[model samples]
Target: MVARSFFALCLAAVAAAHGDHDHDQDPIAGPLQALWYNTLPGDGGTQADSVFSGISTFGRLPYLPCLNHRGINYDIAFIGAPFDTGTSYRPGARFGPSGIRQGSRRLNLYGGYNVPLDTNPFNSWAKVIDCGDIPVTSYDNTFALHQIEEGHFSILSRAPKTDATKKGPSLLGKTLPRVITLGGDHTITLPLLRSINRAYGPVSVIHFDSHLDTWRPKVFGGSPSEVASVNHGTYFYHAAQEGLLRNDSNIHAGIRTTLSGPSDYENDGYCGFEIVEAREIDTIGTDGIIKRIRDRVGTSNPVYLSLDIDTLDPAFAPATGTPETGGWSTRELRTILRGLDGINLIAADIVEVAPAYDTNAEHTTMAAADSLYEIMSIMVKRGPLSVMDGEKEEDL
Candidate 1:
């Protein structure tokens, strides 16, 4: 009886302490602020006191395991493909997605505004969210490729919650959401293109890289196994063969890599891409390059943009799978991307950013993040492709 009474007193004391202990009050929960704000942090907490703090998503966007979660739809979703076995040179590009997100922490700190485009892409009409990274297996390259394709297709097929009533674009009588993938390597584009082709048919490509990436497997020197052929160097060749690319409508910008021979250029042409050499930025200027790209791709067809970070000069972005000298400055590339504001950009990727090779200042990852920000702005400005337009049809 005495021990039972002591236990009862102890329990009462614990209850009293629990009842008396005060928890820290939420700053935004004050009466006036409460009227304007909800429990969910505005701008995904980018406006937090420190930029370096918090879970990192691109531009500090909201993170959702969108693939695993049903009914969580978005107009523009950011998904990471973190497989790098397809890389021929450097191996750390599997970390590209996290590196790019870390670099993008400051993108929306100032209300997510872009003075050049005169818009805040984050606050725009589209429902933008970070879909988190696709769980790609690193064990097998072939299985990883299929995993990426299935993961991307899962997100792309969902109907988005948009600010506008009209659906952006459709192919098989269903409206599709847009995807901005943080890449594993240039090889990731092949699977991405396959998934996009299912929804939009063959898409015109705006490929920005230091290499053509369209080399034939034999010419590029792959093994006897067919699976061995699909590396970063030759995914576009496979994309072309798979009928995923719109022939005669694709373009490659910032190419400056040395080839095996002149026949490599011939092969690139045969794969249906017009090249805007990196050296042309000096001779024809950014305006001329932009015009060439716009003229080649036009404005109505669905286009996929694959950006390899090596497209920037090593002086600017040294941390890539293959760093080539004498490429475009980040500013030059941004200007050209801004000039492409009205094109029908359906999906895009920023690839080959190997942060292990980056400087302490993180120039390569920053360049990749900023370039993706500009692309997002352009997409927001262009809105979505209207379903009724049809002038982009060309012979395949």
Candidate 2:
């Protein structure tokens, strides 16, 4: 009780201070449109700006996240969970989200279908913003888990959850913003899913990974024990036991590994929707994959996409702990992302981008950033900028 009360007071104080700061910074730049630096070729990094310059007036800023278009402020928070403690082998994913965001300098607002940019369809209904990283401890294992659990729940409350917007915040008449997270590793998704399930009923997960993380007690040795297996290897099994996942709707993509989970597949379930090898990418392609994804998850269901960096080929994403050789290329992965535009995706996480493996640090973070852009583009196309001042829907 004391901890909850103290946290609540801290939140109120932080909110008050943020309100004052936003009021000051926002008036300088009225609306956030993708600026010129974004469109111009040969741009170095994400350029932070207080004013909209260049052509089209839709330059995506680097430093500042979330925009207060019109009178309402959208909470498109981009939080980083740099947690590598749960990892069994490699352990530098804590820097994954930030590294990706840093590399996402030029984001494509238009879909590959060549959707006209001047009149993009998705801007009206959504208002996206990046809230930055949550407050968490770095080294302390127990403290990190507690912070990841509590810290994310607070951010989750700010999201629209089931409805398009949330009520009860001081933001009042406007819609509460949606929070997007770039996780440290796959374990971060467990706490995040728990928070979302508590707010909204059982949600479907569209997971993309190289391995099946459904083994409850991961054992890598002769049998499935802690000595053989560890934390990062078993998320799906834990989530299912915790009842945070809807087994029917969950879909796993770009999987090119051999997993041996006995009862997880539900009589040949394939350990939560496994797509072995590059065969799916070759035979069905992105469109076929998208259709299959939509078929499994359905269109209207809210989705939380957890994309492990190992899903990409080692040539493209070489910074993961377990890198499979014949994974899909980056462009192939991007095509899958663009195909799923406007499919009720709530939040996303790009995990397992270990910077240490890549001496150049080019492929891993770059691929991860590009994957994150897919979610950003999907959200942007869903009317993030076009949403008007909406009264909080009580029933929602």
Candidate 3:
């Protein structure tokens, strides 16, 4: 009886202490309250907060597994193509992918630039992952391009396997994740187009560069014996010849370079491209340029946007193999990209970012990263993965 009374008293004492304890002062309770009440940090988290906070991928997202890994699916993948051997002037573009990734560290995933874009691209609009770099051989150009094509094929093949008999909208028929390539140089676009053509057929291109890139192949380095010698300048010519590009619909913007001859213009014209010279931006203005692009590409065509860093004037983006004296300013480029909200953006790349020429501030790389973010925003707004069942085709 005496021991039972003592135990009862002990229980009563424990209850009194529990009731008197300050929840705010309690370590476990305080953290729980903070979880509910604290403002979310913009840089993902503080350095000491989580190991993942410091890990680097584009936008600091988790690394994606290889496509062959069973049951894995991604809506978008950032793949690096780090080859510069095809460059005619400078060669440091091999470092472009790394430089762009490094520059992206300053960006916050939660807040995108305030534009007319409807939603934050990373806000569950699509599933995005970094697939890392496509391995490229430094010595063998032909073999390297083949490897890039094969790597891209592997990523596209990951789209969910569908019924061969089924038919519908091209966007709905797609099962593969869209890709954003960080380039070694502009030559990488040829292999990229080859991969995309296998699935979406010949796509319309939105080419932005200081040079018309459609110069005759032989002018750069091609010969009858070496017909395959495709440099950055001649890839689009080859792309058009191989039936990998929609001739009449494709357009080139920001061209400022002197052509090899009048025949270069004739060649680009024969390829079915309309040219918008860099100086034309001052005359036509941003809205006019946007209208021209939209009218040319239309809503149904699957479009690939290729941005060469030299499209920006050397004053704005100096870190390129071929810097032009007069080109679009960073603001002009960003605004133009912002205007392309509803077009069907299947795949895109930002190329020719040779970091070796950048200033101590890395301004060129930073501009490239911002341009990539803008493209991603456009993709989120128009990509098939983000469309609803009843969504209008124009909205997509």
Candidate 4:
């Protein structure tokens, strides 16, 4: 009892000592004031949040529901399509959008600059924003595709941001805002191309993949339903049928997948795309590959670049829905993309990232994010496409 009473007395004495002096007065207050006064304005979190600190958007970009335009304008927008029902093998690419964004958290930190490009896209004239994921239905593939199309078209239809009003290479007279999609799967590209067709008519495509995605739907053993036929493997064929692609102008790179037969190559040609097989990367090299792509698509045509994560070797990007071995390294791919620097790359998508198969270090997701950073850098370097300073829209 005596010991307990002594303990109580000691606690009371400590409390009295702590409360005796006020933090708001004298020495304590002066130092606190100094610390507060010396602290920077954004130190509390506005201009410089920790890379891991907030809701993940691609590159930590501003989040906007671009589908609800409401007078909102942007030069570039990153839209997320989180539907992956079209996958033929693996199925978790539905989670790709969020996974890619998480991988991109470090992108805009450290001044958001690209030294080689000598520009910072985030700080440049482009008003870039992240339009959160399209609320696509998982139950119905056809309806989900419709939703994706509608969402994409809504963004494509928006007027460009004031500073980014440079004319595009499209048939449209006014400037068109560019959309860099974080894809659900390769199937999303069909709807994306449909939206692009509405804005720019049939544009040339620069397809990067380990598989010849231009396969005819019949090759997949004839689906019972029409919607079932239009999948990742066959969306490009549908795009061709819908007149969404420019004939003889499209090209496929990094193709190394097995085909039904030699007729598959003929079908790919019929779909209006020439192939640069994956094995050629050994003999022709990245520079040669880039030259072939540039030669096929030309420098002035508005190009829609669709990159499948599986284009990178499984050693580098194994987390994709349909990863194949003997594909390009991330470095080789990025270098080739850099080679297309001056070409009219209008819009792009990086798809087929199924994070369910990823490593704990997120190699596949990081590859996708870094590839986007390179693509975004390329876009920034080119600035917005224009129809020459004083040229009229119809003179071409």
Candidate 5:
């Protein structure tokens, strides 16, 4: 199964590289893209049963685990990591996953396209399921970290391992479960890496954030020992040392500030990353950032994307605990993400959304939601959903 999936992935990647086309008129549309509510015969109601009558290809919510017309499972789970214990400045991110889940139900399930929104190496199969939040405490950072890790371990274990004697929770039941984890803080990524390595071997990380979060163990002041505090400030060093992420694959896109101890590492010569500082994005543009990211992660590895909400400027995203001055604009982020239309993204997380910090929950949560949407788009772009074509023939 693993070998088959890998082969399929390779073929998809080649297609995405060569099948590049314009979006104005789609040559390929599948059942998922079949119109459901576009100008009904006589009914112009606002609800589903009335406005959404008929057996359109799109599945109903509480989406069942069934094969679609494209022959893929409906697998995508929304898992939450409520551990702000690592947050440096804010204490409200523990509430992030729950809020984002609530917000998600309020929007269109597929961004109005039943076909996967991803355009590269067009994904032809993926099943998305919202598995709900990972259970953990708010104040206990260590406990929260453990809980988040365990939850993702379950997610990564979605694919059956021949080494294991018993059947385990396989991703979307057949493939790696496409997980979009809602974060408590940047530190939540440590546990997540543990799981990804277990499931797919050591994978590369494509990190996007404001601060580097690579402060050495025991470097943080609040902790009695490095293990004592484990604040959001210390994920990279922990993961790098632990062999969870490839430093070469780890690209830092929006760093504007420095940790008390990690200055020497960010120096272009010191760190093996294209540390594109916040202001440079405008002058350099997202295309450069995307190229740098591709080079950093390499086209072959399955990349994990982690978005620390602080990567955005506080003016645009003020809900984070740490608000940096210069950061990526929403449009800038969208451009970069859209450019990565076909990379095989295994899992993604959005961290540091402190609802308590903003006047209107401006920064963290909203950006997290938008960031999640981008991730969702990325998943569909890289899976079987990508190449699935021919929007259901207008309900015959």
Candidate 6:
């Protein structure tokens, strides 16, 4: 009887020890338990239901409805200027913003490339939000331009309040949210420049295109009764005439299109921009091209980069309205852009992506989307600009 009682006591002790050991072990061991632990109900919990539902925004990012342009709480606004009335050849770039956004879905939350300068902008300190397409007037070009300018101005006019104690990338000790515009067409750049010029007078331009786009406005051949005639090819001419460009600092790269006459070059020169022909890539090389760009723009001037999809050879990007045969390849453009780190880039746009012309591969829109990401990475690395009393000043 005593032996039986002792055996029962020993079994009880062993059971207690085993229970204690189990209690000390982690509750979440297998994949199912880990998933359950991570997906609990509350803040910081994963919601499987809303994983990928809803309207697709840029890069599938969180959509902040900015219909009235109020409650703006982001460092970078990805806005769509969806009007292609300004196109000279094709009429489908109005769909560019959507196409670019769709292509961006393929990008993960990691750095775009393996290069030293290719960090992910979204993962940086900057807060970005997609503020859907601006409501442009389909019938009236002047009204559409006005709306586009106002949309940009509304975002630029207000500077986010930053903690003065912390030192980081910002404009004038404050954090002013920069704008990365997904364009309708190249002509949209004219109004964008207008809005930017209002805040930081006469900034330099880094124009990438197959054509100079500095053609005379008379090329449009509109009646005197019509609204101020403007097209993708001639907006820069107007921009120059209005003193909105730093003529001595602006530049055009990857131009291979035939000029109307020698006066075209003369006019472009008068606007204060040097041209780097497409074939020059072979002669001077990528490094030399980057040097020329940096030397021309300098380090202090506020720069606006406008990339026309036509800058890529049609073989690679055939969806643009004006595809030149001899142009920079995708790899060359990526290297050149990566080399342009540390420039004071304030505002940027990627335009002229007519997705309708894109092949089954969707190469044009994908290139545009990737190029946009590259530009955004550059901006994030540069950080915010220095503004003083509602104006952008050169960094001291």
lDDT of each: 0.86, 0.62, 0.79, 0.85, 0.62, 0.78
TM-score (C-alpha) between model 1 and the true structure: 0.86
Measured on C-alpha atoms, candidate 3 has an lDDT of 0.79
lDDT of 4: 0.85
lDDT of 6 by residue, 253-356 (tens): 99999866888899889888899998999989999899999999987777899999899999889988777898999989988888887888878899988899
Q: Is candidate 4 or candidate 5 better by lDDT?
A: 4
Error of 6 at 393 (Å): 18
User: Taking the tens digit of each residue's C-alpha lDDT, what string does model 2 give over 166-262?
Assistant: 3322223333445667768777777777776765556688888877777556343233453233356666666776777766788888776765654
List candidate 1 segments past 4 Å from native: 1-47, 163-168, 386-396
Clashes of 1: 0
List residue ranges in candidate 6 displaced over 4 A. Answer: 1-54, 67-69, 109-114, 161-175, 220-228, 387-396
Count residue pairs with overlapping backbones in model 5.
39
TM-score (all chains, Cα) for each model: 0.86, 0.69, 0.82, 0.85, 0.71, 0.81
Cα RMSD, model 3? 11.9
Model 5 RMSD, rounded to 1 decimal: 12.8
TM-score-superior candidate, 4 or 5: 4
Please tell me which predicted candidate would have the highest lDDT against the true structure.
1
Model 6 compared with the native: what TM-score?
Answer: 0.81
Could you give candidate 3's per-residue lDDT for residues 253-342 as a string of tens digits? 898898668888888999889998888888899998898899998877778999999989999999999898988999999999988877
State residue 224's C-alpha deviation in candidate 6, in Å: 6.1
| CA error at residue 171 for candidate 6, angstroms | 11
Query: Model 3, which residues run further than 4 Å from truth?
Result: 1-53, 67-70, 113-115, 160-172, 222-228, 383-396
